[model samples]
Target: MTHASKTTTKLAEEYATPIFDHLTGHDDALYIPLLNHAQSQGDVSPVINLVRNEENFPYAIAHPLTGIICLLAVAESAYWVPIDRIAHSESCSSCAPIWRDLKNRVRTLKPGETFYAAATTHSPMGETRILIDAEDLEN
Candidate 1:
């Protein structure tokens, strides 16, 4: 299996926090299937490619799934954008929290430490969490 698929399956099977439960809620039914489809058909890359081709693509950065995907793309060094676009954009309001969270994660990284993007989970109410695995950086 691909790394994304392994990560998706791990998240689907291993984690069960209340936050995850709440975020998933009803959409839990669709999350795994969509994740599988994205992995199988490589849908994630097209979304990231759009971001690469157009940094200011209207709602691309603000929609939860796409936003988290963009964040993970950046995290994995697959996409690049100016710091201003990530931090100061009113156009990406829905993604503001993610930007802030990314900054926070970076701030906590120790010397010789690195991180890897794992997966994104889309909630029923249109929220997203970009999973990162600092422990799996070597992989």
Candidate 2:
């Protein structure tokens, strides 16, 4: 795990409080920010968002490469609320496909490359949470 401080300016631009970048499918523009945030901070735990409720339905993860794609079958502006790990464990089984695809992409990632996805009940939804290790990257 790693830790880093982020200024309000940076947060506003990336994690748009009232307006987010849009949690779309696995693309570069959507996921790159999450990866960049994690890489800059040296940890993936901080930038990841988890959604488990219907109120904050329709969430998308922004990618620096692919723009924005819907991850949870939600709209482009959906807001996702975070849930606990217990909920995540229980809901993850239903949400395995998303992570499986992300993992597959991770396997093909190169150095300085990044991926993003929405976290479900079981998986952490919202911004791109997974960051490939620098050493794992070929570049």
lDDT of each: 0.32, 0.31
Off by over 4 Å in 1: 1-47, 50-91, 117-132, 135-139
Instruction: For candidate 2, write residues 26-127 as lDDT tens digits.
Output: 222222222332254553322333332576554444322222222332222232322100012212343344345435555687765664333323224434
Global lDDT of model 2: 0.31
Angstrom error of the Cα, residue 87, model 1: value is: 11
Q: Give candidate 1's error at residue 27 in angstroms.
A: 25
lDDT of 1 at 58: 19
Backbone clashes in model 2: 30
Candidate 1: count the clashes.
0
Tens digits of per-residue lDDT for model 1, 10-125 = 44224223222332233211111111122334432122211222353312232222222222233222332211123322234443553455445556767544344444455322
lDDT for 86 in candidate 1 is 33
